[model samples]
Target: MAIKKKRQPKTLAAGRPPVFHPRPKSISRKSTKSLINQHHLLEKRKRQAIAKGDKAAETAIEAEIEELGGIERYQQASLQGQRHDRGGDSSKTLMEWFKPCFAEGQAAPDRPLRMLEVGALSTQNVCSKSGHFEIERIDLNSQEEGILQQDFMARPLPRDDTERFDVISLSLVLNFVPDPRERGNMLLRTTQFLCGPERHSSTWSLRDFFPSLFLVLPAPCVANSRYMDEDRLIAIMESLGYAKAASKTTHRLVYYLWRRESKCLGPESPFPKKEIRSGSSRNNFAVVLG
Candidate 1:
């Protein structure tokens, strides 16, 4: 009985491989070269397709290229007319360029003034083209070197404990913040920071903040149905002690000159409640903070 028990042989289960398994193919220079060649062929095909106006194929190739380089970098590199030269005008220079927009009764200063520009990069070039005054630029993302990096909603400005700036330019930045209250807060903080604690004390009121502040916003901001209406925007500014001295709309852009006066509150609607006083010979509007 013991001798008969040793006669059975081993067998693999049905549909299963044998106990011995093949090792995986290793990545090698030859394989890598083959892959690269395949990629090049695919790219050539894509180019040919694009030349023929085959949109779907072109899109597929673009997607592949984007995957290789990452979408953001690819977009940044390929986009044309992303940057424009504004002739090296600083904010002060641009102020003069826009000075014709100022209404009568606004004050004009004789000296070079400090200006802060938010969300302005190429516009700074335009500003510089005017050759007026020194301007400091702040942006969320800027390719230009030496500009301050900041997100209006997240980062607070540098606290230098001095009311040093004469002009703060916020152009095309407010609408980016989706919330009206937050937008109002950002504007308030900007004014408060520029005006300093001496001017921003709780008891001091709006007049203590500034004699005049200039604000420019896009017309779409007023017409946007997703956020606060123009009336709400005006109310928020007025509640925070800003009065609209003058506002003008051209095409899709709406420009506002807000004044902080000792006695005047802001307007109740998008319409100007008072005539804006033009300063000097320039048409630029001014807000009297005090």
Candidate 2:
């Protein structure tokens, strides 16, 4: 028997098959475009944060971008182009501050002072003029032959006490750390390289830290009402038993020189600030300089 033919799907007026469009395909394109736009927005914000020396903001933005699956692009973009010198020979010029120590025979003149430059992009023979400093450079984005690639924050201390440095320079380094507690930890970590007490000790004597810490902070952040202002930083260092030796402000940067103070404080000095309380005790202890 001739049964009724099943109803056929309708075609276009021209008798051509209807074009099939997957809803997901269009939705995916729209979502991709949205993410790209968001990526761009985050990038712009990150740049602004860097320019403003707002490291916390930059870090937060980075975390957001990473969550959006754009970390690879961000990393590639960050590594592109020739690395430029952040702060010039000013650091070298400042080396003169320590000259008195050498001239007075407090420190050995024969052996060049061992200096560690953290976050270094280009080698600055700051100590070359006097042949007084033997510099070791390290950076997170090392692209050169001599600079050791490392995240100064996460890297472990030298196993041997003798391997520690006589001086450590953090030139625009702390600001790059995303967490305020981590930034404080970076300050505390400086003691690891400084000519100080044994690293293994749970507590450190204030007198043990003999190495000088040279720091360069962004001028805007130092002067403005930011989370990492100069005053706050000075307080943190003071809490750590570091007394300011000299401070100067360049057109765009703030230079600080600190020496470990001889003053002794009871175990309970200035307590750890809020940011540090939740972090590793090493960080908290470092901040307290106990």
Candidate 3:
């Protein structure tokens, strides 16, 4: 046993211990500082890209930050506050008040009440929300994108099918048509389309058209592109066999609620007369003599 003695491992120069080796603390500190500097450089570059309006570069940075799970922090730092105000006298407004009254008594729920809108953009949202009707819009130009595809004056209505609608809303449409006769014809045609041939035994007549109609027109007194006085419009409607039930005129627009009648009741028509009422906040008017 005493023939050979084993040798121990070589120790450090300090001779403090053989197992321990002190790390280069400066290297570790330098590496951590490098990482922090790299992060700051990246954020600065992203800001510069955005400031320069380089969309692609900005997108790339956003994507990289998102992948690194820093999207929420980026959004919080970049986003700004927006302000909105929803306060006013809503009741006194004409269209705002008229909508609820029309939706009161109706039949179909599943299949929306079909409406033909003329000279206006797709009134689907307006009609559906206010009157609860599905709008089939027809304008002068091909403007309304999806709802219906056609111009009112340019093309004749498709009469091959017998499908009909419950309501027809001609809002701010007739004024655009220059010819009063054509306007009258358009009004009559609208009624004919809504009341399909199958519904009646005899040929379509203006007297037996729409039971109820909403006509929103501009005042003739106003000097605008499409403005007609109340008397002239009433005469035209009367000629087309529409007896006005209610009418109201504001500063810009005139609204008429008409119904088709069986027979003409002498020359003296029942179209409502306009009455103006002044309000402190806003002017109010009523149609009393229909």
Candidate 4:
């Protein structure tokens, strides 16, 4: 009898995300949920001040962050929050939403798809090992080998369909772009880097199909924002020619898959910062297009 070889399961990545790199011996286990949230809020305020040309406020916030161990320390803390052991890997959910397409035979492994992962935190996530996707990962501050240090806003737009992606993953990225108008512009930019429906056999007509967006936002941005709710978000995406295909919400995050149903916003599309809802406890998070 011939010996049989075992095959590896495709669902899990061959390798796992490593612990935070260059982690100082004295700084081990130094990050907490509250600390991470503080860093996020502080960074957002810094960005807002810089964007508004408020030099004094920007200087003050920079001094405060620097006093609190600087941006590098905050970045390391954020990475700790993303450790696989902490249930911080958002791409796992993206893979779950994608698997059915391959299972149903709509996508083939031989014809591997392309994806752009913005604000990527790891090189060994499940999507990178799927053997069905050629992923291009980028971040503003890349601390790993595979992810490039590049700003998504400054990345050269695809010259043609061959240069565009079948999918785009914008996980936990938009919230960091402090200005609401710029946040809206970033969403508009993704449409340009996506391969349109005509290139694929499946139109964004079906759920979990290619030419789609996997958007992950902090749940509070939708749930507790005075200006935003799930309904308002759906409406904004509609104006940009995408239709919500699926959604899920947890106490910490809100995830959605939006299919590119039509062309994106033109030069003059208008989505202003008008209050749509009111609540005393809500934070101000709005995506404005001007």
TM-score of each: 0.48, 0.57, 0.44, 0.82
Worst 10 residues of 1 by lDDT: 78-87
TM-score of candidate 2 to 2 decimals:
0.57
Stretches > 4 Å off in candidate 1: 1-111, 153-163, 196-214, 224-227, 262-290
Model 4, global lDDT: 0.80
User: Taking the tens digit of each residue's C-alpha lDDT, what string does model 3 give over 29-53?
Assistant: 3343344334435655787798799
Per-residue lDDT of candidate 2, residues 37-124 (tens digit): 4765676689779989999999999899888766444323322211234334556645667655555434343344577888665554
Q: Give the C-alpha lDDT of model 2.
A: 0.60
Error of 3 at 33 (Å): 65
Q: List where candidate 2 sits over 4 angstroms from the true fold.
A: 1-87, 102-110, 197-210, 262-290
* Order of models, best lDDT first: 4, 2, 1, 3
Which candidate number has the best lDDT?
4
* Model 3 weakest 10-residue run by lDDT: 80-89
For each candidate, how many residue pairs have backbone atoms clashing (under 3 Å)? 32, 1, 5, 0
RMSD of each: 21.9, 17.9, 23.1, 10.0
- lDDT scores of the candidates, listed in order: 0.50, 0.60, 0.48, 0.80
Q: How far is 162's C-alpha from truth in model 4 (Å)?
A: 1.5
lDDT of 2 at 154: 75
Better of 2 and 3 by TM-score: 2
The parts of candidate 4 lying over 4 Å away from their true place are 1-31, 51-57, 104-110, 202-208, 267-269
lDDT of 4 at 246: 78
Q: State which candidate, 2 or 3, has the greater lDDT.
A: 2
Is 1 or 2 the stronger prediction by TM-score?
A: 2
